[model samples]
Target: MFAEFRKFVMRGNVLDLAVAVIIGAAFATITKSLTDDVIMPVVGWIFGGFDFSSYFIRLGPIPEGYTGSVNNYAALKEAGVPLLGYGAFVTTVINFLILAFIIFLIVRSVNRMLARFEHQKPEVPAAEPTDVVLLREIRDELRKRPAE
Candidate 1:
């Protein structure tokens, strides 16, 4: 059983999947930082410095004895306030779009590279079928014999 498990784990596809998952996770972190720190800030600056993540609709009353500001979404949520955080949803959508576009570009470039390699490959002629070879051999043998 242990050997079977090891064999399963050692398969090329399994190892490739594991590596892809790790790299994908790291790429997601970088994408998130790009969305949150760089792109969103520039977008906010263009739109009069309004933060998208702070836009929310309060669905319920704020908890009593809450010292945090009412306009702050994170603080209000921490104080058990029921709120619809649409701004955060928008930010998440943007992040997903960016990540998807980047992945698409990478796949497209890789496909183009693969196409170039395919075109560069030297073409080898296919071998004749067994029946065709045998027929040719019989024809040659008959041609060598005396006319009958």
Candidate 2:
């Protein structure tokens, strides 16, 4: 059973999948940072600096003994207030779209590069065998001779 497990783990596909998962995790982190740190701020600025991070609506009343600010979503949630956080949802959607667009551009460029390479003809030709060369020369010489 141990040897079977080891064999399964050592298979080329399994190893490739593990590496892909690790790389995908790293790529997700980078895209998340690009969305959160770079794009969202610019989008916020474009929309008059409206920050969606704090956008939430309280559905239930605050707890009677709560002393925290009512406007704070975290505080309100802590105080047992039911809330709707539409802003966070919107922000997440925006992040997904940006990440998808970036990935699409990368895939498109890579595909174009691959196609260019595929279309290129090889610079060097393989040498023909001596017999084929001699046969072709004989055939050409016979064609060049005038009939008697």
Candidate 3:
């Protein structure tokens, strides 16, 4: 059992998968940061600097006494309101697009490199010509026969 376990651990495919998982996790973090911290804010600034996150409609009812705009989704939800978080969904979609684009570029590069390697002609041993072999055989026979 120990030997089998050792073999499984030492397999090339397993090692490759472990490395891929580590790298993928690291890449995910980087892309998440880029999407959330950098891209979304710029997009938010573009449309009259209105923050989409603060945009939500209150469904149930606005209290007659309380008159203030609900700046967050949680506040509206607490007021017995059904909220549609379209902005959050858009942000999530952006994150997915960024991550997917990064992955696509990586996969494309790897595929190009692999395709280049695959298309390279392999060195093959030259085959002996049939006529050459026949000629050699005839020469050998002439030499082997005793002089008349």
* Residue 130 local lDDT, model 1: 98
Q: What local lDDT score does residue 68 receive in model 1, on the 0 to 100 scale?
A: 85
TM-score of each: 0.83, 0.70, 0.62
Q: lDDT (CA) for every model shown?
A: 0.92, 0.82, 0.80
Worst 10 residues of 1 by lDDT: 44-53
List clash counts for every candidate, in order. 0, 0, 0
Ranking by TM-score: 1, 2, 3
Q: Which ten residues in a row have the lowest lDDT in candidate 3?
A: 49-58
Candidate 3 TM-score versus the reference: 0.62
For model 3, residues 4-100, the per-residue Cα lDDT tens digits are 9999999999999999999989988998788778887888888655565555555566656554556667666666567777777787888889999
Cα deviation in Å at residue 100, candidate 3? 0.9
Candidate 3: where is the Cα deviation over 4 Å? 1-10, 57-69, 74-82, 120-122, 126-148
lDDT of 1 by residue, 1-148 (tens): 9999999999999999999999999999999999988888777777676676787899999777888899999999888999999878988999999999999999999999999999999999999999999999999999999998
* RMSD value for candidate 1: 2.6
- lDDT of each residue in 1-148, candidate 2, tens digit only: 9999999999999999999899878888888788777877777778676565557887778878888898787778767789997766777888788778888999999999998998895668889999999999999999999998
Q: Residue 75 of model 3: what lDDT?
A: 62
lDDT of 1 at 17: 100
* Candidate 1 residue 65 C-alpha distance from true site, Å: 1.2
Give the clashing residue pairs of candidate 2, or none: none
Instruction: Kindly state the number of residue pairs that clash in model 2.
Output: 0
